[model samples]
Target: MEAAVNDQPRRGDTEGFVLQVRKIGNSVGLILPKELVARANLREGDRLHVAELADGSLQLSARDPHFAKGMESAGKAIRRYRNALAELAK
Candidate 1:
């Protein structure tokens, strides 16, 4: 953990946390600081989504970014091909 600012302890000066992945039994995990966990409102059973970007970096978030876009695309396709899909189903 880097040095904290006045009155508040953040991950670092750049607002980024440099975490190290550690081995836990047979699995590997990273430990988040108490400040971060409380800030994010994350729980033990909560699910986190991981996305690999084009720059070879990984992103972790509470929601899947691609899921929303995929759902939007699916909705458009369904609206555009509703008649054809209905006929094919029949």
Candidate 2:
């Protein structure tokens, strides 16, 4: 999807198309258009990093330090919890 232009103050990113929030299980989510996703260099199941700026505005991106650390930890956690997780499935 092409970017949407407006008077809203923002940084780096050009305003894009709006996505409708819908229910996914008990959580609400917004579906980004495939074109927009491709433009943003995002793919299905890709994680995003979000932060709130000092000016009370929000930012979203793909780079995340915490996520990197968590990913490393996840490898260990997966092995540690494998038996428990497998048992829970039954």
Candidate 3:
């Protein structure tokens, strides 16, 4: 899916394309265009964090620095207590 954004649009112009919501099996999803994905540096199976702004607009980002740091700390703890975790799981 190729999309072309008008090159001469003024700043803050709301000239955005509308995407249809499609049913994917039991879940619904929106298909993002390949060009947009490439510009975002996102790939298949990559995680995206979506947040709703105060104006009801949605923001999608590829990386959440805070979440990444929390995950890194959790990973270190898990590695340090691997044996204890395994024993607890038994």
Model 3 scores a TM of 0.54
- Model 3 gets an lDDT of 0.75
Tens digit of per-residue lDDT, candidate 3, span 29-82: 767766667888888999888888999999778988678999999999999999
| lDDT of residue 15 for candidate 3 | 47
Q: Can you tell me which runs of candidate 3 are displaced by over 4 Å?
A: 1-16, 68-90
Backbone atom clashes (below 3 Å) for every candidate: 0, 1, 0
lDDT of model 2 at residue 21?
Answer: 56
Point out the higher-scoring one by TM-score: 2 or 3: 3
Q: Pick by lDDT: which candidate is best?
A: 1
Better of 1 and 2 by TM-score: 1
On TM-score, the candidate that comes out on top is: 1
Per-model lDDT: 0.77, 0.73, 0.75
Q: Which 10 consecutive residues of model 3 have the lowest summed lDDT?
A: 2-11
Q: Residue 19 CA error for candidate 2 (Å)? A: 2.1
Could you give the C-alpha RMSD of every candidate to the true structure, in order shown?
A: 6.1, 10.4, 8.3
Q: Over the stretch 1-90, how does candidate 1's per-residue lDDT look in tens digits?
A: 332233233366687776666666787877777777788889888888888899999888987678888999999999999999999999
